[model samples]
Target: MQVKRFFAADMRQAMKLVRDELGADAAIIGNRRVAGGIELTAALDYPLQPAEPVKPNAALEAELRKTQAIIATAQARLSLPEGLTAKKDCQLFGERLDDFKNDFTGADHVANRVAEPAPEVVGPAPVAPHAYESASQDARGLDIVRSELHGLRELLETQLGSMAWSNMQQRQPNQAFLWRRLQRMGLPATVAHDLLAKVAGIAESQQAWRMLLAHFAQAVDVVRDDPMDEGGVIALVGPAGVGKTTTLSKLAARHVLQHGSQSIAIVSMDSFRIGAQEQLKTLGRILNVPIIPVGADQSLTQALAPLAQKKVVLIDTAGLPAADPAFRLQLEALASRGLRSKNYLALAATSQAQVLKAAWHSYKQCRLAGCVITKADEASTLGEVLGLAIGQRLPIAYFTDGPRIPDDLHRLRAHQLVSRAVSLQLAEEPSEDTMAAMFASFYNDLSRKVG
Candidate 1:
């Protein structure tokens, strides 16, 4: 094999010279621009020996004939344009020659005149395909790539959205209601509706949930934040066994374990749940902190008032039925107490998105500083709850995974939450057994319905 470099102003000229020098099958290795000319590198192969010729069958002979005919037709058509140009030039040259020659002849004057030039007949150019079809196919391919890239972007965003952090807390005993009220006024529903529509596709749960998470993160990004660090006596409020009491206890323990128990005052706002007050009282005693026992809603103001010496006065609020009117009234007392509070709604990540939103709305007054994502270790899908929390703009203040008091509690991190959501999405995908069962159930239903 030998390689040669050719210089031409354009590809067509270069290719023509290449074909003239080497046979048509010569390989074009490379091409580039060099100064005033285009450079093309090509290689030609010469076999060492010819192989034994195979006998040509009838089909092969027919193909060869067709190929030769097509080549001949192209070559014939190719000659007509150059030939017409030549004929026009020859007629003009003869006319010029006649002007000189005609002066020399009085006889043969008719012969001296240039022969009348024949009218050139033009043939139609070979039909070429219109440009639109090629362009349309290219555009369609580009659209598919764009769609895939867009999908990947949405998936990544859904995995990265987390909540706003707050450093402020309320010191007044009844501030739990104030936090609830603040959270109610959070971002509008239109935010969720629009962003969710972007990532949500018409697919089954297993295939579509990642997109759901993506839009949910976008939805949460709309809620703005303010400084949440004021030391107000706010309480952890939620439904029973929602880990409110445990969450409250964790706060108290951390305050004591991090700062001396005496630095963080404990206020027991839960007079309803049996032994709820006792639980806080026991924790307070264990940490050697004062437990200000308050009974009625009005009593909260007085108990929280004496805790000014404490750095953070944490109120252990009772978890009531979310629908209780009395609990609403009690939570509303935070405003009357003139205290600022953040109502942290404790939520289990295993709950469905709809249920989580309901839980958020149920305490619609607690200005839910966001949420306390609890029992993260128990759920397979954090996206549902995280989507709910972000969708609500209620930043996670804490993430509690286990019963281990201080060790299990962590500040809400968006990346961690989204990563967990992605994992949960993968985990939630139906297994082979699940798919088979689903098909079996579907067939049974179809059979009954059809019959």
Candidate 2:
């Protein structure tokens, strides 16, 4: 047998070197971690007749078979109990087997050629097929065990959560009822838990319920006066389809109705969307307000400079995505110290909690003066928007229930908003299992906070 030692930064590179120099029939006799990486000792039967097929020497064949058997045993041992450590071991074993292959056979033959240096040898030995089959069986078994353990873990968590919920109902029935009520109202777990924690000592159910609503209403911040009446230069900012244009029209119409149309001017900064400028022009025509169209190349400050005589210059911005370059440009323009613009985020009440939150985070970069809750009449529930308003302390300015210009807009009232939210609560309570899962998560959060 001809023996040669190869060194590389890793097993894969070492195996590649062995294959390239010694051809694919090389067998890895021994391998160990060296100073830089891996050192592999490979051997191949030599002094063969070129006319006939090369046959490995008996001693070397036996050693290769012994090595294959050892590798098979190790792979079998990889079927350890399902856990983080065991999963890591299985992954490491599979990776090592793949590295040994190194484009010799292909990824599918990772389990084949157990002691071979290359993934695919020029000609596999007689023992290779058996080794491949055995290793493949071990890997499949490990996968099956891992899947079963994952299912078992999920089942265990569900059962434990259910048990914990039942125990909590027995110990603190009032608190449990409140949790269910809050969950049914579609309030986020963190917000509901904070309320529950605050009213933990209130044993009486009715009083607890009353206090919860009171606390919820108190959390909703609102502007002291109608924003339309006190506007200098107010810009409506939010994601697309949230009624920024409609809300701006409503505000302008409201101002037109109360004060003369001459004091207000609608500056259309939405040059991107088709007919967006036309829509504002139409509204301006109906309301008899001046429509100043700012083109894409026009500076917003210079545009506003011409309208300095106008009292309430409602900047109707393009409802582009927060990440868009144009959107950031508009935000930076609105936040400029020269304009002194008070930006109000136009959030649709019908949007999901996450969507509303994302909108708030996006527009908040411009230092939001307040939020205008639009599409209230179309929303199934107001809890999500209310939760966002309360959590962010974003003062609610005006809410529009319909598409009507001035009639649909109403000033913010905390108690009325809370009542509207409570009225939209789910008629049926959540399932015991669902409640149990929620409670488990809530308690986990509480524990973490306490710790």
Candidate 3:
């Protein structure tokens, strides 16, 4: 019999080499893990030696028969199932052989089992490319199903909302009219719904409308006394380019005209801007008040120490992005208990509702005393800022309509703000689809609470 040895990185590779070099009929006798791979000893034509007959002793014969029976039982238990592929069958056979050797060879052999080939050396069967493609397709199909379900949910909501709105118009026409009127004024559905709830049982449309306007005006909280009149250390805080410096100048000019510039001073923490300090200096020159330019290295407490005698010290903070470390530090300084400074958020009326809201959240860390609505003359509608102030319950201290310094800054008047919002109301009614989409979630929330 011609015998040869084959070496390969894995069992499958070794088996392939054996078949290619020694042909399909070659019989594998011994296999072992070698330096970098496995070694298989295969023979083309293996010789089987016949056993000679022996004279039997009864006791010895009984012991030999019992051992043969145990060997047969173990082989039967380790046999591979017919359903498994040839590759899997080969792997299972090798594992079962190792297990059998470990069990019968005693603890010494089992302890040295680490010398045997690791299971990972054989590796798992390679998954076909089609299997991965199938899985990817399934994931894509699931995403499509989710998207369709979301669209279906929105459609159902819109239809249900249309039906509910129709019912409201038919049952309570007066309330429906007032709700539509509020919507025309550009009020969010949530705020309009809340205001509508206040005049629930009023049957007359005109009276209900009048009462709604009154309630709307009352909802906007304002400072009883103007900041210029009250005169304290006030810091104007907001995002960059919302007119902090301009608003500060306006406040200083107003205070200078009314209370004299001697009692007031301006502290600029806006050193980061290119011409910020210069602008404040120019304003200081015009108003005859001292403009204290606070550098990044200067402590706000140290800067304000000498100005303790001043009645109104307006701080014009740098309009830095909320993410900046300096922005947070400035807010922390203003919020410090010892400073006792009233921080007022400066919001631009021309900004979108979301921008206005974000500005409020960013500056609110300073314990905002109130807000100053800037750029009112440029804004097409006042509803956005009005809604923000009313929703956040932030008192409006002043409103600046123009760049005319003291001429533009006016004390907050609730009725005038409400009337301005009304005058800017949209002339055309909202489309049916628009109204349905807007009120769908609102009506659904109300139904859930009522039910």
Candidate 4:
């Protein structure tokens, strides 16, 4: 069997690449999302009919010889002085364990054993110290087991998530096609399936897509009431370099535009980076609002005491990884200090699904009320961001597609998001030939239906 891997920005394109190189008979083994796009692995069995096995080519023979030589050299190095090696030790131990198991429960022993129950005997009372020690050990063991189970559960969930798309493709091609349409835009398979399932039995492609988008729009939750309208403390939290400060500045500027700069106050908790405060301060200077810098030792409440009377207070947090120990500490400090703020995770549209998921999971500790998608102009696909929001049910607060201060920040509308996602998906299509092939197949089906 010969195997090849193809990578594309989406699944349909990946499948096209696979079909072009491996032919229609190629069996797809696996597929997954990589750094830039999706990867598909397809395999083909060389011998299609009964025949003599093909012999290896000269190049293959040479490669096999080289591989054998490398293996021999590694084996020689791993050999011990007495002929026993690490591999052999493991093999021997496994064999002994198997033998022990067989010996302990042999057929003869089962036949010779009595079936009658034995009389109960009184047992000694457990020692207090031993009982306490046993309890401690059991508690520790239970913790370890729970941790392992949790890891296993996450692994299983990821695997199951991957299978959802493929299973839908196999079971219901038409519904799966609609599902992939949403998936191509970067939505999770499970989310796409759930949406598609709602509009079942729709045969026409255009009608299906229309229904899908309409349903998608209903499912999407946008910021109905902007935090700035009736805002207290609104913090922008996300991973590093996701344009958190810029987003905060945009929101602050937007607030200033509507309700004068006097009613708004900008506070910076992003003391980790050298110029984070300066950027917000620069925006503060531009908007004519005070940018209060809160130090590590300073209390957030104390820092914002003067701004208590302000209509809106936008807090800019340090863009740190969710897994960082410091992130939890920051959350703890915010909670302990009674920094009641409506947190909004600043996610970039250019981020992959996993990266967005990580950001969502991490900043969720802040009790994020919603998300604000930034860098929309820079992002080639909005599907990943949209999918993250829909899957997590995170309402989108605002969208900043460009760098324009208050101008670029627009309210999140469901129709606009769906349109952008579809446009991006269509824009990423492969070359003319691939598109022609797809259209030709569609034409043939239409012609047959007419006849």
Better of 3 and 4 by TM-score: 3
Q: Which regions of candidate 1 are displaced past 4 Å? A: 1-230, 335-337, 426-451
Write down the lDDT of every candidate, Cα atoms only: 0.54, 0.73, 0.74, 0.67
Looking at model 3, which ten-residue stretch has the lowest summed lDDT? 106-115
Q: Which 10-residue window of candidate 1 scores lowest in summed lDDT?
A: 160-169
User: Which number leads on TM-score?
Assistant: 3
lDDT tens digits by residue: candidate 1, 1-451: 9889889754445666789888798887766656865677888984446656643334323433443443344334323432243223223323322332232232123222222233455986453496456555544544443333333222222211100001011221122222222122222223423433453343354334456445445444311332123455666776667777777777777766655655677777677776787777677778898887776645667777778776677777766675777677667864353767666778887676556777788776756665778888887656566556655677677788888887887764465565555555442333332232222232233334444
**Cand. 4 TM to true fold:** 0.60
Against the true structure, what is each candidate's TM-score?
0.47, 0.66, 0.69, 0.60
Model 1, global lDDT: 0.54
lDDT of 4 by residue, 139-175 (tens): 5544443333333322322232233323334454676
Q: Write the per-residue lDDT of candidate 2 for residues 1-451, one digit (tens) a residue.
A: 8899999865545767999989999887766666987788888975444565433334434533443444455345443343323124324434433332232232223333333443555775566568667666656544443333333323333443454566557666897899888877778777886787778789999899999999988888888887677768998999889999988888888788888888999888888886777889898889889898887678998888888887789999888886788888889999988888989988898899889989988888898998989998988778788888878888999889998877998885899888878988888988886786665455444444544
Model 4 / residue 58 / CA error / Å: 36
Deviation in angstroms for 177 in model 4? 3.1
Tally clashes: model 2: 4
lDDT comparing candidate 4 with the true structure: 0.67
